[model samples]
Every structure is written in structure tokens, then in C-alpha cells.
Target: MTNTTPQAASAAESATAKPALIERNGIEIIAEAERTAKPRDLFWPWFAANVSVFGMSYGTWIFGFGVSFWQATLVALIGIPVSFALCGLIAIAGKRGSAPTMVLSRAAFGVHGQKVPGIVSWLTSIGWETFLAIMATLATATVFAKLGLPSGTGVLIAAAIAVAALIVVASVLGYHTIMKLQGVLTWITGAVTILYIILTIPHINMDAVMAIPAGSPQAVIGALVMVMTGFGLGWINIAADWSRYQKRSASDASIVAWNTFGGAVAPVLLVVFGLLLAGSDPALMDQISYDPIGALASILPIWVLIPFWLTAVLALVSGAVLGIYSSGLTLLSLGIKIPRPAAAAIDGVILTIGTIYVVFFAQSFIDPFQSFLITLGVPLASWAGVLIADVLTRRVDYDENALFDANGRYGAFDWISLGTLVVASVIGWGLVINQFADAASWNNWQGYLLEPLGLGGVDGPWAYSNIGVLVSLVFSFVVTLLLRRGKIRRQEAAPATDGDN
Candidate 1:
């Protein structure tokens, strides 16, 4: 992919300036050097992002359903690939449109109307950032305790603050810094990940672990949703934010394959390690923490604990940085009109407070994390459905300038696209049932589609198989296509009416 297409428009500027690594590309067309990433470059960035306890706990969650290690690993093996592929697929928009995913959506949702999804995407990014911060803080505190320091409220709060602040600093440095950090840390984290798997091999009891029964079909389905929702759908909103840096000539297939494989490496391997740890021991659930580092300490030697703990903390911080950076982009995409770095700083501040509360105050991780992922999946998946359909059907032949102009051809509001997003989100909400969450946690779930509506019988299957996301994807796609068909008809008719006059 030679981006030899001559720097978007400004040839002279492309030759003179090396592109500001920290500026905003949220609402503007990505000019020259900013479009420097290749398809292969995406491999490590994604690898570093997925290598964390944030995703590890999801693997550990499978044991809560009483699935065997082998069975749990099977579910993960199936789900992780499916989810990561979506990341690759969604990333194509970054290259094709020469903009962030949220900016590209302006072609779908209209300039002003996009604020709705933009806000949702913003919250999604912030939610991820905040959640990752909480995990990192707790992980660090747990590690400190293992090292014979305080893991009490004071220590937890301090760790949370420190981790959140560091992430913010990295994030405010913007795109290149995050990628560079990830590139370098990918090696450290990758080594620790390998060491983790190696240590776990010495403890594996294949006979007993394999004997753990696969649960009922309903339960299996629920576990599938848990793994897929936690890993896959959670990433949909931010796919383009990272991929937009890929040169325009980057291979679509390479982008998808690299993203799928690279992103899958750490999560799948770590989750497998987690599932095995749980399935091998009956007392596993008793030791499970929101941060899985403590749980690892219980099984591995104390000598192995510190490096694993420290690396886990670092990976979690990296994950949060990705979220912080993208949340800032989404904020700008919402038409905030602020400098990108400033937007990132503002998000960092909020994340700091959120991290403190979740780590020190809330003192609970699994419930919130599970519910958060389920809640985020619906709207994002539905939104992806719209864009996927548009790309496939050629509905995405957009005018780059018109995307930003409120009075231009795309307009300030596109009721058809906006309405599709709304309806799809509603359906996504309804069918989504938090499989891992208790009834109390269920009440707070965004995917709590059935309870408030008061439909018991219908809720059972809907919650079990959870077809809401599927329905949202297909429904939005079909609806958007129909709307485009109608819009084109009207446009053609207007020309005839003028001719008649």
C-alpha cells in the first residue's frame, strides 16, 4: 500500500511538515504523513492492546458457569476469532474514507444527527478507558500486596490515581505515542504472556481439567455470549480510530487478517491460561478477583507473581490509553470543536475520578465489567451493521467535504439513518440479557431489554440466545438500504420536475 496518492491535496505541506503526531484528526480529512501506518504495523498495536487482565477476566468468567477447562477453551477459541475479525472488517473504513470511524459515520447519520451515536461512541470509549483504569489500579494494588505492601483502600486509591494519570499522559501525547508505546511494550508484555503460559503448563492437570462438564445448551449459549460480547462487540466502536492511520493503499484483506490474528494472539492465549487455571481447581471461584493478578498469585509461585503482576498492570494501562485516545477522538467527532489533545486531557480527568471510585469505592469489578460490555455491544454492533451494509451496497460513495458541512449535500440531520440507529439500538437492548450478571446487576444493565417492558415468556429465549444484536445488525442494514433506495428515487424525480417546469 504505497500512499503515493500525493498527501490528500497539499503536496507542498506534505513535503515540508512531518505531520503533528499529537493533533486532532477526529473531524478532518487525514492529510499526508498522518496516513503513515501500514497493514503490518497494525499487528503489534492490536496485540499490545488486547494483552491485559481486562480481557483475561472474561476468560475466567466462563468457569462461573461450571464449564470445564476444555469446554471453556473451546468457547473462547470460537468466540475470539469471530470478535477480532469484526475489528479488522471495521478498520477498512479508516483507510477507505481517510478518516476516523466516527467521522466516516457522518456520511451515514448526517452532521448534526451524528451527535447521538457520537455521544454513545464517546461514552463507549470513556467507559472502556475508565474500566481499564479500574482494572489496572486493582491489579497494581493486588501486586503490591503480594509484594508485601498495602492493598488496602489507601494503596488502592493511590494506585488508581497513579495509573489513571499515567494513562492520561500517554493518551494526551496522541496517536504516534500510543502506537510507539504499544510497539515497545508489546515485547515486554509478550514475553510475560509467554512466561505465564509456560508456568501454567507445569501445573496443568489435563485429566481432571478435561472432566469438568460442559453445561446445558442454554448455559453454553450464555457463555458464548459472555465471551463474544466481552471481547468482540466491545471493540466495534473504536476499530476505525486506530485503523485510520493506515495508508490509503493498504490491503483490505491484510488489514482484516492482521487485525484478527494480531488482536487475537494475547486475548485468546491469556484467556485460555485463565480458563485452565480455573478449571483445574475447584476452589478457583473463591479466589477470583476483578483483577486476575491475585488469582494468578494463588496458583503460581511468588517468584513468578511480581513479573506477571507488573506486566499485567502495564498491559491494562496500555489498553486504557487506547480508550482514552479514542474517546477524545469521538468527543471531537461529536462536533466538540476543541483541539484533540485538550479533549483527551478532559477525558483523562474524568477517568481519574472514575478509576478512584471504581477501585476504592465500588469495590466490585465483575458485575460492572460484565454489564458494561453487554450494554456497549448493542448500539455499536447495530452501528457496524449499518456501515457494513453501506460499504457492501455501495451506499458509502461519500463526498469527504460534505461529511463535515452541515448545509452541504449530506445535511444536518438524516432521519432515515438516524432512525435506523435508534430502532436497531432498541432491538439490541431488548434481546440482550446479561448472562453473567445477577438480577440486581441485571437491573442496571443497558442490555436489560425485557424486564422494564414486562414480557416474561418472550424474555427467556431472547435472553438465552440473545438475538437482539443479530436482529439489530440485519435490521439496520436492510432499513438503511431501503432508505437509500427511496432517497435516490426522490433525487432522480426532482430533476424531472425541474425539467417539466
Candidate 2:
């Protein structure tokens, strides 16, 4: 038998504890052989790519719908700053830890239990990618429709081909190439929109803005909840996903700062822009035109409008392809094991199906997302809350190997964290359900237990919807803290148990 010294063992443990990679250029990128090429390889490109992704095809219609310019601006101004602050705080951990969102799931879900959220992230990516693809195709067809072109199946065919080609190029070129193109398009989109807003400022409908609906507080709050879910969380919420590719290192604080600032500013701007144009009598499709392209056409000369509109379409498709490509990579990371090209092809096909359903078949743009938010979005958002709690309370930072290992520091199942998630989700959803139950029969339970608490019932704040994401999140965070605190008590009581045993 051989005996090892305690000092040697300690040294080995210390070496194992070191982080795998360092931060660079405000990105928490991994060390690799083939680096990002120059120009597009830098931070501004990455920043631009991210901004373009958030700047969408239906921005004008969605943000501007039903609200005055100032009112729409009010929502963006107030909502964005609050939401991004949370994202920014989380981004700091990602930058410092150099972990993807799924990788960070280990801390909250347990080493072995990570597969729960991992699969959720993967599935969500697939669904959202498909939805975006469909929307892009629809948007493109609408642009042609506005031009008095053929409004038949030919439009769908052309849009599909265009979107698929863009996705193929983006997937093959990978991050660096995408970012470079994103930088150029970002400037283009921004320039056109800013110019259009300035031009259209004179046409603002001040009275109509004041008349925008406040039909029910429940609906308004529900919409606000949706806004938060849309902005704050994503299928792949990892801050490091982009930052990991940066060329230089910055503090965790810096990453959070940039993410928060950008996130805060972008959505508000898009929504506010949407509101400014809300009073236009154009068709819904026209309202959400790829950008200010058609609107610009209305404002500018025929010669200039044609080129500018084309640029807007190019940028819009580029942004959509980026989403598809990113989601495909995320799917691959989830163990799809297919080559990038092959996976992108598969994603493109699925996206086509989703696009058709959303754009051509569906009556409303927000319906699918609303459904998704209540069912899938709430649970995933709950997962985020639990993760934040775990990171803060447990301090159970897994080493890289442990991140991959099923039975490392985490048990076969971290029942504590899992239990907290399940309980919080059930209770939160029950709040939504109890609202629709027969009121006269179960009125006591519904009104007394659920209504006042905003769970469910006639006057309940979150009735007829499975959207207690905020409530679930708050409950999950509280439960996690209690469990972690209980753990401390258990440790203290351990010696007493030994004596009793």
C-alpha cells in the first residue's frame, strides 16, 4: 500500500479548481486554436449582432399597436431598464464563470439533474426558431404583397428559399462571419429607422395615443408579464454564449453593464418606434414591414426608396437567419451530434413548417407566443429564478469535469432543488387554474385562496391563464433560500444525531 501526503493532495485539488478559460474583450470565450478572423472578430461586431437580433421584422406593429407614441415609449422606457438589470446581473456570473446557460444549470438543477433544464432549453430553441422563420417568411411575402406582386403560393416559395439560403450561409460561417455581417446591417437598420422616425415625427397622433386601451388592469399586467418573459429569458439565456468569443478580457461587472445597457435601450427603442407609427392606416402587415422600408418608400423618392427597402429586407432576413443558426448550434450542443450544415438544413425545414403555421395560418402574431409563455415560458422562467437562487445561496460552483459528470459533487438527483422547482411551479400554475374553475361551487377556494393572492377567480389578477411566471419565480427563489438555510441547520444538528444514533 502507498501513502500520499496531505500537502500533495491539497495541491492537486487547488490545481483542479482553477477556471478553464479567461475573459477577453468583454467576452468570456474559451481558448481555442482557430480564432475569429479580424474586423468581425472584435467586440463591436458581437454587440451589433446581438442588437440586430432583438430588432425584429414586426417591431413597428407590435410595439406601436394600440398605444400613443408617448404611451408606447412609457412601456419601453420603464420595462426595459428593470428587466435588463436582472439579465445584466446574471451576465456577470456568466462572464466570470465562463459558462453557458445550460452549463450553469448544474448549480441549480444539480449535476445529474441538469438534463431537465437542458432538454427544456433545446426544445424551446427549436420552437422559437421555427416561429421566427415563419414570421420572417410571412413578413417577406407581405413586402411583396404591398408592391402589388402575386399574392399566391409563389411568395411563400420565394421567401422560403431566401430564408434557407441565409441560414445556410450563417451556419457555415459561424459566429465571426455572422457578427461581421450583423455589424454592417445593424448600422443600416439603425440609420433607416432613426431617419424614418425623424421624418415621421411630424405625423404623430397625440390624441389617439391618450385613447390607447386600459380596458382591464388584468390584461395590462398580463401583457407586462409577457413583456418581461420575452425580454428577460431565452431558450439559450447564457450571457457567455456571445461574450466567450470576445478578443479581450473585462470584469464580470463590465459584461453585465453592457448587456444591461444594451438590453434596456434596444427594446424600448423598437417598441417606442412601433408606437410612433401606430396611428398609420396601413395594413397590419404593412405596419410591421421589414423596417421603415415601405414607410420610407412612402416618405422618399422612388429611386432611393427601392434600394433602401431592399437593404431593410436584407438586414431583416440576416437577423432572422442569425436566430435560426444560433438555435441550431444550441441544438447541436444539446447532443444532436450532427454536422453544422446538416443540422442547419434540418432546422431550416422545421422552421419552414413553423413559419407557415404562424404567418399564413394564424390570425394573430402574439397568440403563439402567449400560449408558449403560459405553458413553456413560465416553467423555464421558473428555472431561471431557481438558478439565480442556487448561485447566490449554495455557492456550489462545479468544476469543469463535474459539470459533465453525472455523479460528481451533485447527487444522482438534487431532490432539494428539484422539489423546490416542482412545488413552486404547481402552486403558481394552480393560481391560474383556480380562476377558471366553477366559481359558485368552488367560490370559497377560488376567491378566498386564489383571488386575493392573484392566483385565479373572477377578479383575480392572473385569471384564465397559466402565466404566473413572476409568481413562480418569486416562490422558487424563496423556497430555494429556505432549503439552503435548512441545510445549514441540518449540519449543525448532525453531531447531535451522531450522539442520538
Candidate 3:
């Protein structure tokens, strides 16, 4: 040891050091795999999880509302292809880059602009997670009350315990674990729901369903659109959260197709079941509105009802878990230095707070909670639109090194992306805000402008708010094209320099 030279000693130390498997910026990526190892994801499990998450888009409420089930079915069937294409285009960008949605947003927004969307996603998810927790509690209580525990305080307590457990379980695992759980939950929940639909079908009043009139001709169109647009807007904004775990080699288009298809179509059966029950027994519908549990219990056998209730509760937990995990990823992508577990903890806490709000004081907070999500659609759509433009312009390729290089191609303020996002969001949001301002607001406006629509006058923005989602997408793409033209012109205008320089 005394005779060893400094060079030899240094070499020995180097030889003993463990090689780092992955690096990002200055961060080590050791949780899952080595840098060279392609992402290992539970493909089918993840796929089923996504489908389940998407199914919640049209779960219970649409059925409970007692609208035309066919309208919802049509909306889901048609909207799936369109929404899937948009989600697929954005997802492909994330897939090719091996980046999450927020990380990819950095290419379009400056690192500064990146945070706006990140916070938006984070805050929105917190509210949603809370809503899910509350809904789960409500659903659990409803199920128990139906089972003869009319007071349901015990049911509520049990539901709270269950929700806490789900958080703990979801917290301990990583993406692989979550995906597997979600897959099993989806099948169980989906099967139970489908069975409920089959059983409930015989109870529907076909004559009343036919005579329902959709609440005037115009209202019918509006309700129909609402059903379609509602397909997955609530949580679909975070599709990338789960999809990011998907192996890059998987055909993303297929995932999007299935995701959109499952999300859009599966709930229609549930709605049909609900509608049949509502149509056949209007008195039962009215009674259960105040006591939803009692209403459902009467329709379902004790065995059928218990599993159905459990399925709904599990589904709620599933949505909350996905939201929390995705929010954590978005935080990480934005350069938060916390450990993944710590990040997830922050989400759980936020969700817990939201759950409290829902469980103890739901009626007051619930309306605004839903409105907030409706408002979020514009911005989420805008970001999604920019993502599509960025991908299409680059011909579906991004240099991996550029993501780390400060002065690299992906760096910089993409004015086109930013500007397009802002403008589109404003225009789309205007559609929502104007609908409420005044009837005079619409009367004096340009005749050519489309009026905001809603569901049978039950909700505002009677038509599909998804129009905002669609418009934001189209406008962002068009603006990106305009900016691209300007970029090309400016590049040609400048004098040439040496390639190395």
C-alpha cells in the first residue's frame, strides 16, 4: 500500500466504483433500469388500466341522469376515433422522446413557460383526486345503505379506511405495480358493470325511452354532443401519465385506439342500464336521487349489489391513484428534486385534503370542483394541440441529446408553440365564458359565431365543451404552420456561416 503510486491507487478506486446506469440533466435514473435498457412496462396491464381510467369518463352519472342512452352511445362511438387521434399524436411525441408530457412541453414552452402547464396539471389533478375520493365515499355509503344499513355512518367509516388503504398501496408501488392492479380492477369493474347493464335492461321502458324527446330538437343535439365530448375530458388530459410507462416499441396508435374506444364505449352500456331502470321506474329514479344507495339496492340482488358497489369504489381509487402518480411525474419532469416517493406523498396529501372536502362537505364544493375541470379543458387541449404541431413539423422525431443540451435544438422559446397555445385557449375559453355572460351577449355577437351549448338545460355550455378541445387543437396546428413559414423565411434571410461555427 505504501509503495503504490497515485495513478495506480486512482485506477483501483475507479475500478471499484459502480457504473451509473442512467443520467438525466445531472439526475441519476436508477429506479427502473439502465440508460441503455429500453423501458420495461406491463404492456397489457398498462393498456387495461388506461381503458379503465377512460371508462370513468362516462361512468355512473350519465346513467343516473336518465338521458337517452343511445345519445351517449353515439357520442362515445364517434368521439373515440377523433379524441384518440389527438391523444395518439401527442402521445407519440412523448413516446418518441422517451419523455413524459411535461418534459416534452419544455421543447415548446421555455423552461419558464413549462411551469404554467405543470402547475395547471398538478392543481387540476389534486382537485380531481379529491373528487374521486369523495365520490368513492359517497358510492360506498350508497352501496351499504342499499344493503340495509340505511344510516350508513359505518359504511362511510369503512369507505374512508378503504380509501386510505388504496392510497397507501398505490403509494408504495411504482408504475408497474399500479398498472397491474388497474388491469385486474378494470376487468372486475367492467364485468360487474356490464352484468348490471344486462340485468337492468329488462326493467327499461322502451316506450318512455322513445318518447323522451331529448328535451326539444335543439336540446337533443346538445345532449348528444355533451355525451360525446364528456367521453374522457375529465382525466384524459393526463393520458400521458400512464402511457409514459408504455414501452416505446408498442404501437401507440393501438393504445390510443383502445383507450379511446374503451373510454368512449364501455360506459354506454352502464348508461343504458341506468336509463332502462330510470325509464321503467321513474318513481324509483326520483327516490334514489336523494338516496342513491337505496335506489340501486332495490334493483340489484344482494350478491350483485355488493360486488357492483365494490367495483365503483375501486374504480374511484383507481382514478385517484393514476392522478396522483401522474402529478408526481409532472413535478419530477419540471425539475423537482424530491424523491419519487416523496413526490407521490405530496399528491396523496393533496388527494386526502380533497377527499375530506368531498366526504364531509360535498354538495357545496362539488359544483365548483366540476366547473374547474370544465375550465381546464381549454388549456389542456391547447397544450395537446401544440404537441401535435411539434411532432408533425419534426416528422415524428426528436434528438434525445437535445433534451439535455442547454443550447440544443429542443431548447429555446418556441414562440409558435406558445403563441398558438395561448391564442387557442383564449378563443376556446371565450366560448365557455360567453355562454354565461348574457343572452344579449350572444344576440349582438356576430351571426356567424357558434353559440355555446349545454345538456338539456341541466348544465351550462349545453353543447359539448369538447368543441373547445377540438377548436384549440385545430387553431394551434394552423398557427404553428404560420410560424413555421415565418421561421423558414427568417432563416433564408440571414447570411450563411461556416457549418462548424
The candidate maximizing lDDT is 1
Task: Locate the minimum summed-lDDT window of 10 residues in model 3.
Answer: 23-32
Q: Candidate 1 — number of clashing residue pairs?
A: 0
Worst 10 residues of 1 by lDDT: 492-501
Estimate every model's Cα lDDT from 0 to 1: 0.72, 0.52, 0.55
For every model shown, the clashing-pair count is 0, 15, 7
Q: Candidate 2 — which residues are off by over 4 angstroms?
A: 1-29, 32-72, 213-219, 235-238, 246-249, 279-315, 318-322, 339-345, 357-366, 393-398, 431-461, 464-467, 485-501
Error of model 3, residue 204, in angstroms: 1.1
Q: Candidates 1 and 3: which is better by TM-score? A: 1
lDDT (Cα, 0-100) at 360 in candidate 1: 60
> Residue by residue across 63-126, what tens digits does model 1's lDDT show?
7765666677887898788878877877887777677778777766777887888887888888
Taking the tens digit of each residue's C-alpha lDDT, what string does model 2 give over 15-85? Answer: 44323232111111233222222212333433343343224323343432333344445556665566666
Q: Model 3 over residues 417-472: C-alpha lDDT tens digits?
A: 67777778777665543222232233222111244332322234333233555676
lDDT of 3 at 481: 64
The number of the candidate with the highest TM-score is: 1
